[model samples]
Target: MIDLAPHDETDTTALKERERFAQILVLFGRHGLKGLAARLGLGAGGGEPLEDTRPEAIVALLRDIGPVAVKFGQILAMRSDLLEPAWVDALSKLQDRVPPLPFAAVQPLIEEAIGGPIETSFSHFETEALAAGSIAQAHAATLLDGRDVIVKIRRPGIERIVDADLRLLRRLARVAERRIPEIARLKPDELLRHFAESLAREMDLSAEARASDAIGEYLKTYGVRTARFDWELSGRRVNIQERLRGFPASDLDAARRSDLDLATLASTYAQAILRMIIINGHFHADPHPGNVFFLEDGTLGLIDFGAVGTLLPRRREELVRLGLAIASEDTGGVVDILMLWAGDPDVERVRLEEAMAELIDRFSNVLLDQIDLADIFQMVFAILRDFHLALPPDLALVLRTLLTAEGFVRRIDPAFDIARELAPIAKELMRERASPARLRGEAGKLLAALGRAVLSTPNLVGQIEKVARTGSITVSIAPKDLERLRGRERAGRGTPQLYPATLAICAAIVFSSQPLLAGLLAFGAVALAVFEGVRRR
Candidate 1:
């Protein structure tokens, strides 16, 4: 188990650290730092900042803080659930461009991990790094057999810095859980822990190499064009992969100059992303333009597979159901999925229904030719956030990556219709649901479960009747069960207060006879009544 104790207060640099943290918060606010600071407990009275240059401020702040901060900004950029489109666009520019560690610092790490000196393993190894990033730097090297490859070396002691930051974050998450009642339902601490695990995996070069190989195998199985790594040359601190020479995905001018079909490229990417999620159940979690490349023949090369998301077979089925429900514009189906996925199943259904309706109306009715993938994804994200429906961690990352991929596609071709391409894939998934084999398997499982329950019903009824007669009974309740029950009770209690208050406000507004006020109140009254009814049920 991970110990989440607070850091010891024994640093001589305490004053400097505190001052730097304060400055960081201030800068974060400049990027809409006010809102970010408020989330971090640095704001007052819930008031807006006097000056707001959120976009430029955020860009400048990210540029100043180096890789980790820039990486954080990139994560935030993918969060259409937490931020607006304009901010997402600005934050997308937070590229991984740290200065490479000196060759002196890297050579030793490679030698230690590979159990040999650089000279023993390679015929030629460049002393200069080809590229640098937050966790590792890469150098061009030629193997003993003369095969060209890139050797990625993890920076020594970087893990300590990451661990310290994560430790502090976990502590802050605990404080938020205790003090910020409004956000408790979101499970910020759990989310941070999930991110911490992902970051930890990224710090291990061997783990990244493994992930790359796994994803590459999946891609090959699906007949998709993707790059693979040489795992034999990988170790704890070093990853060696075949190097490809191609222009980055963001270089649209270069692609146009090279006779690449922008629309076809966009469609290929969208289809690849959908297949990764629905069929393979695994995907690269970060698909920004910088990590993608386009070769002259138009084969897309995906690199940097450090961050990834995977869904269990069951979760994949549920996700397919959710996607189909959205495609069919079934608000009830969407609400059911949202409730099933939420920590609290007893959440206000009316609110969820309203959000779902808004989402379906916005996304489902848009003309296929006119639909923008980024906008559609943002709408879906907004609905999830408005209803406080937290997605499972891995699924959330996949969704964010999809949104980023959509943004990249849009940048490549303004007229590219991602949704139109995705619609067919969604339909195909729905068709798969109706396959005879799948249906039979589902039916057989249901029948078996029902048969068992029916066979045991007499004894169950007898026990219940005995308990009812004796006025005593026992029921086993696990810790998770208890938490779920408490969550339901809290939601139930909160429902009534909102309704009566809303009714009173509506009555007052009707008495005043202000048309706009009356309309607003009427809407609120209807919403409250629905909420109350759903809660009672």
Candidate 2:
């Protein structure tokens, strides 16, 4: 029997929820941030606020709260753009090291997953756990055919616990966001969503196995290795993969102690990361040193596939445009991209453009080699915060991955320059972009969008005709504009089919394969269609 001072006390009607709510409140009050707790209506006491102090206390509080909080902290650590340096530094030190459960506790679960006693698949399984985290545990074992592998098993009932905790966190984040301006500005709710998505994927061992297969195979060209999952024995809760022999990427001393070409390894690591993001659009979201291993056979071994991010083709193009715009100080292009990400429609464009100019000035003539990417991006985010703009979740993940990848590689060799390596990749990408194949692809995309725009037009026409006959929807327009819109309709009625027919012909070659073009064409195409509609008003 416990009581907590949470704001929505009346809603905790469920007996288990009330207990967990009280537990969370108790942990909050015990761990500092009394002011934050009070502000969120979860505590009776008040003290310094979340922004005022206690990075260490916050880290301790997260660890105490459990794995979900640690996972959230891990995300926050990668977000130096949105968090204070002290908080970032503190949270980065929170490791996912937890005491392992007895082998007996997980044996039944494994036996069920493998469809028989462990002896059927594994020749020799270690009774002692190799590693344990909040969601899963691992054990060293030999397969029936005598190959070494790591058997990872999800902790029994962890799914239900994680789901309940996530729901609680969502409510807490929403409450905190509404009550605290600092928390609102930090976008706690959005961060929580990102964390929850990744956590769910992490818990799904099958999804992780697939990611390992894709990313591992892709990295082979760059001298990187990935553990291959034993698919026949893998399931949603259990997965076994070949054991990789390597030292952790963080073990710089171990790396130096070996005769490997550290610089070459560092370059390949950075290059692979960029290619995945820039070219392939799928990437390991967290390439932190801890998740990477320098293997015995001169290849980097990457692990932990629970979280990945994707940038669609258009997003990749926008990123490239943004980079070129920043490099060339193209204020209009920069603002155009920023407006897409502005959280509020009322954001002042003139002010935003002026702010962009100042940011550009900071790096005006500096060589790319001399620029500190992390500093530039941090400043950009700070300005976006000032302007009430939020980075799209995918782009934020990209930035975090870039920062982590850079840091990971730089740790291996201090003199390694990612920007320097990127110049060549950039050139190669340019060549690919200009290739005849790319030109044909781009052309095909345009005509397919044209077909979609034309295909969706009849719906707009039906609405217009319905309004004309029944006035079911309200219409607003200037009288003179209305007259002009009417005037063009009668004048253009005979000429409408020329382009539509041409579009039909061109789109036959393109639109058949564009079935998944879910949204309307890009904004420019939408604007053209809207302009046409308005002209016929």
Candidate 3:
């Protein structure tokens, strides 16, 4: 089971830093992350380090570190374009299951969040939790209005603990940036910022409720179902949503007994999700089997909106183009979409196109119905990483979501193909792109862009002309490099201060062991100091 023990103020105080450091060191060493420990400056003066590079060791290490770290691993796992495939594969297996806290621990929090005693607010509230995750616990409750609901309460004192962990994580990211040059391309600090942002959003139950409500309303348009929440009863720490009574999507036996058509259900799920991404530009980031329910009424119910992904309309269009390009073996088109998505990056166009060509060649011959979208996308991401191209967090999250959704669909129906499922959406997007209205929109956008460029041309020309005349340009120092330089300067300035301390230590050591040598050394030291001082003057 995962560790869910609450850490108090004492655990985050400066006094516990050494203990925390030691814990990190030991865990790292135990899990073959000793290289990281050494990079973090904790491996010296140690026993034989475990240097195993198994991906499982990495997952184990993250899981052992608790919720925040696990979430970090999850975010990293989704970044296939920034990480090795093995690491991504292993981290994908990290689960957030933790033992439930005793009912008494969160009882007061629930009452306080809804502003009353539990008895007064609910017709009946179960003391036993229905489920417990790392951050929160959900209880089966009936509202005072006699409606069934799920009461979710944040774990007491978790915010303080997560905040402390985030602080340490940022520090470690800085350390990694300074020490691990190879990992610098991953932009650890920037990644941490994304994680922290998502984490903060997740910590607020109200934000999740709103997200759920929005997605729920959106899903209804597609005839999909999700649990509705009582926004009035929801607060930052507490959420009361309708309780879902359905079997997990993976429960094929239950699905069959309920006369559910697995194929139709899978198709419905795929269509809804694809439309959510391609049309709505918002989707559930985590759509694994556990979070998906096959309701008795033949519709799927999505739960847990804590991790939602949103793409801009432009990005959605680009993604649609990317799909169609891959389908048609348009290598140049693939590279073009990728370049647009990746923004300004140092790219070898020929090499990237060649890689895309190879990717197309590999999957081109495969039948559409047999195409594995997740595998193809994974390979594309791998090649992107090879070329040092990184996807923004939004795109990474989208890819992660699609991959996860594919995994769930394939688990119960191996014959189900993600590419085949996405083809209709891709075709629709293509149709829309070719429509007269879209054409007018595109033409107008282009003209507006040209107008803006024309307006800025004089300033651009002036800057270029100035640069040409000056024959030189000043570049600002990077903060990381500046910090390193300052550190070196400090070390240089500290050398003289160490001299007197070094002499005193040497004298003490010699005097304690050999009085004759101590006396001679003391005389020599005093004479050298006097001569050096006179020379300086």
- CA lDDT, every prediction? 0.69, 0.77, 0.76
Candidate 2 lDDT over 1-537, as tens digits, reads 213324575565455676887787788778766676777777665535666758898898889988888888888887755776778889999998899999999999999999999888888999899889989999999998989999899999998888887878888888878777887877888888878888888999999899989977888887778889988899999999888888887888988989988998898888889988888788998788878888888888888787899888778877777878777777756876776655435565556777888889978887766767678878887787677677777888899888888777767777876568898888987898899998898667666666777788887556535544563555467865455445435434223323443343333333335522312222333545544443222
RMSD of each: 12.1, 9.8, 20.8
Q: Give candidate 3 misplaced runs (Cα > 4 Å).
A: 1-19, 29-35, 43-54, 417-420, 452-537
Decide which is better by lDDT, 1 or 2: 2
TM-score against native, each model: 0.73, 0.78, 0.78
lDDT of residue 79 for candidate 3: 91
Compose the digit string of candidate 3's lDDT tens values, residues 179-214. 666567788998999999999989999988888888
Query: Residues 112-206, candidate 1, lDDT per residue (tens digit)?
Result: 86678888879999999888888889899988887878899888888876765555555656765765554465576766777777777888877
Please report the candidate that would top TM-score against the real structure.
Answer: 2
- Cα deviation at 65, candidate 3, in Å, is 2.3
Residue pairs in steric clash, candidate 1?
A: 28-33, 29-33, 29-34, 31-58
